[model samples]
Target: MNPLGPGDPLRLGPYRLVAVLGDGGMGRVYLGRDGTGRAAAVKVLRRELAYDQNMAQRFVREAQVAQAVTSMGVARVLGAWYEGSWPWMATEFLAGPTLDQHIEEYGPFDDLGVRELGAALARALQDIHAAGLVHRDLKPSNIVMTSSGPRIIDFGIARPEHGLTLTLTGQIPVTPGYGAPEQVLGHRVGPPADVFSLGAVLVYAASGERAYDGGHVATVQYEVVHGEPNLSEVPEPIRVLVAPCLAKDPAHRPIPAQIAAACATSSGTKPSAKKIWQLGELAADIKQREAAAKQLISVPDVRTPSAPSRRRLITALAAGGGTVLAAGGGGLAWWLLSKDGGQGEARKPSEEESTAPPKPWDAKRLTASQYEDGTTPPSLWGPQEGPSPVVVQPLPVRDLVLVHDGGSTTLGAYNVIDGKRKWGTDVGSYARYVAPSDELVVTVGPVTVGRTGRLLALDSATGEKKWTAPADAVHVIAADAESVYFTARRDWRQSDVSLLGAFDMASRTTRWTVPMPVECTLVTPPEAATDSGRLVLCGQNGKVVALDTHTGKQVWTLPRQAVAILPIAPAVSKGIVYLGGKSLTARKLQSGEEIWSLPAKSEFKKTYGGWGAPVLDGDALYALDGEEISRRDRRDGKADWTRSLGDVLQQLDPPVVQGKTVWANVHSLDSGGIAVLHKDTGKPAWTYARDGSGGWGMAASGNRVFLVHGGKLTAMPVF
Candidate 1:
């Protein structure tokens, strides 16, 4: 039975409980107030849990650590004591929803929002790390979006540097999905692990998708250790940031300072001292709205006509008074003259002042052709133009590209550079996946439940479908300039039979189909083309088999822990294939020999897959994590420079990179307006409101930004 109810009070030391806020796995959180009615959140441990000596000691230690930390982003512990059979701790009551609740209610946050959250949390972590503490449970549920800023809660799972283990038998200290690989394996974890968990939390907050997902706990754990994170919906610019945080090895993960700096650089927005003030104002506004709603409901209506009886009496009195007034006018005039000696003088207006005309609420509209033509001469590759499409809205600037999940059966494409209609073609029953190549577009469609697949090759410049094939029997893993390679499953009924195959693009012929072990799932296809004459396959059980692309012959097989195989296209400049899953491993295409394995930082806990497939621009490999995007040395994965984009924002679209400018579109929770940011340095370039219609999606190309609201589309110039 619950002991607390609305308006019920229970005294505990210096505070009196007003009501129960919530109950979690560990204890009950209460809304409490002191004698003077100052409110606080009181956490009371469960009787069974409190009875354990080790757990009780840990609880006290957490309280002490929390009290010692002075960061406003962390909840400050105010009091602690044991009452009756329960141990309790008190902290200042924060009036806001949990990060999880906020995301669920409002969807994912935008780029600006993500940046704000990332920076604030980074600062919070800095304090924690400085104090030699690791907040192992740094999930969204433990973070409160308080009026002042994000306040991290739940120190119960926090681990200090010196005193780490504080657990009872049969009590597993774990936060599934958010836990790092080390934590899942029951290995001793440190601050780096917390950073990894933080990345996972940010990914969830930003994309509303779990980085590692499976039907069961064991499967999820397996995927966390070996599978690539499903980041299909995550924005591209931010995707790079989330990658390193999900690195399997903790040592390779980035520190808090690096994370903070990276985020600042990514969003070009730095955390300011006024964040707390803004947070407070936000909280106040929420409270005000709630109060107004209550007041409106409680007010009574008063609308009734007055009685007619008084009307007749007043009319007769008025008739008699009129005659009297005519006679008494001379007397009344003398009385008025006595009452007032003179009238007041009026003031003159200033010379410069004049009545101004009201401003007109006019909006500019650009047609598809006008938008496209605007990008023609000077900006050759700008977005496309057409009757504004109902799908993903295109942005100004040629580099911005749109990858859309077409309705029902078709996958659509619009060039962001000039708002030009690139292509809209039907692939299958449902086009679930779409990926871009320099010269080709790869689209995957699920035709049926467990028995269908279709892979369509489309001309990049035009919307013409180059070829369509039955992909259900074969996994169309990846493609390149030369050919497409796929892994085929034979007796899927046995759960283990599969084969690997390759198709020559020019000849339009199947080159080879090599048999493989049973129950094998194809990782990402090899990055190199079939013309490179090599194929790589990683099985569900962790066997990596290399094959000759032209002939069905095995080249070599390497054993690894069953993990997701992230296929990298053979580097065009460097000629190395980068495969990353639980760990980042670079292998030679011809020899299949190991090149190098850079250990992930110890703090990273979850894998949202490779952030951006080891983007190789030159000698540098660009990577993304929860906190920031980093450029690392391609040869040894050495850090060069890092930039941070704050926490994940709700309703955020993936970022698009143009020449030197990276653009991200974000929508606010309070007002559904669109905010565009320069991706390189997370700075706001422009913010436009859509009033009540609400923005659905946006894309950039050339000079125009195409916005979609319901069925209506509007185009705005990038400059």
Candidate 2:
């Protein structure tokens, strides 16, 4: 809590404000007391926004919603004045830390404690649902632990059951990793959505980690909508009780009633919240908070000179939970403030104006069936023939899979759903040169007899040219958010000299162009990958160079670490790049510092087989060496497990990890198709065998694996 500042109102209606609990963009929360000596957490609209009709109405709605819910698991509303020049609302002051704070201060709860917490939260949801409301945001930060039990707070985004989830232009509706799938998808939410949130909350309470987490917000939200809930750290008994509540489909989830019943004790009695809160370290913490609250409120007023500065005293008390009284109330009504300070309309994902392409097809989640052991999973779309074998995996962008048309020098976009051609344009290159940048596909046009090739950006959906760059490009190496890196001729006059160049996507101009090594030429364009701020270029003869993406300056280089006649794949993650060829190596992205290296093994002692590009998923790095596929730790080059194919494959293709299955292209004299291996054990699960094959080019997206072999293209479910 902080001392009252200039222009701070000492009182609101009957309550006299003492100290500030917290303040944010929307409003300020103050500790107040009434004539009867009753304490209340008073929330006032910011003076700058108080005059706005929408902001003022939100305060009224919050008060009404708070008062409508009749439950011991929430703070009771005291009084509200929305029509006044300064709108404010008061609620019963709550002491103790929030659920997230407690979880951080003390460890996760025991099994019994988790059950009691779940039961109380379930009942709270029951009350909130009965009032025809859905608590759109129910993360740990919105839950406060009082002496009585856990109390849900911050109803800022709460709306009627029919309400569509939406937020301001720059804000997300709910917290990442905790929001239910429907909420994350911007769908209309109901009581079952709250049940799903409860399941996630219980997971965190039991395991001390989020049920769904990722490096980015979009990634976490994607996991909630499509990925499975992570329950590996959760105890078995609790897992059985909570798993049903996290079902992706709202209809499949257990309701609050069912959750409450399942969490009951063996005696057929519901877990007691009071008993749970009155014991252990939690009880001690709560008692200390209550004592501090009593002592702070006992102070006569902020003007009492005899007392230490109320601001300093309350700020000190804050750490002990004394000033935690409705601290969440300050930023509670965030959605009320729009860019223009008017009521914002509901914005659904499908309705929003965005340039990002639609996510690729996810057939497995739609079908909801796991393939039986030893049985090949069915294809989601096709084995439709006509596309030539690809050097790179087919790119799934928007609704189409971009590939090189069969034996033609044109880029073809095929429908991801049914493997039908959508559009084809003469890109004058193979599939290896096409790169996706949101809705735009970047590629190089065919360089005619006397004219130089041009860089083009076509709409992923319509294949219409959107932007272009004048460069004598031979190959479209790769693209990141900022720029596209490619190998191009110096100019029409110096057409014989090959140069490495970057084209800024935003500015639509040449960023920087630098001469490539004498070994790198136009005929054999290097295989390049860009990420973070570095561009990794690997030559066909195994020369590797790293250049700063911002400026075309070379950062580091590796001198023929690989002895492959083919392009060695360089995969980047975090700050390290994993390369495969003569040896599987992990090196620092900025400098050529070696992190770890593993020698490739072969049946013949005199020969060293090349390793495929390393594929990274979580902590595991997977690559194929000769006939053996190995899964090793990404941090160190130590192998976790390995599986060998009796017959060698056509090429050293990296294994693709999707869901729980690792899909690898297998081609031998006797069998040729896709090989499915268990991600954890590296044991063969099933194989889809195809007769007469030139090996398969594979890519996994939206829970489906896309394979391009010979003139055939197919999409299979991940199982």
RMSD of each: 27.6, 24.3
In terms of TM-score, how similar is model 1 to the real structure?
Answer: 0.39
**Highest lDDT model number:** 2
Clashing pairs in 2: 386-711
Please give the CA lDDT of all the candidate structures. 0.52, 0.72
Clash count list over all predictions: 98, 1
Clashes of 2: 1
Q: Each model's TM-score?
A: 0.39, 0.51
Per residue, candidate 1 scores C-alpha lDDT tens digits across 84-165 of: 6767777765444567755543345545456667778888988988887887777787786755677787665667755555
- Residues 352-423, model 2: lDDT tens digits: 111123354545342335667688867777788768665446888856787777765778888878888999
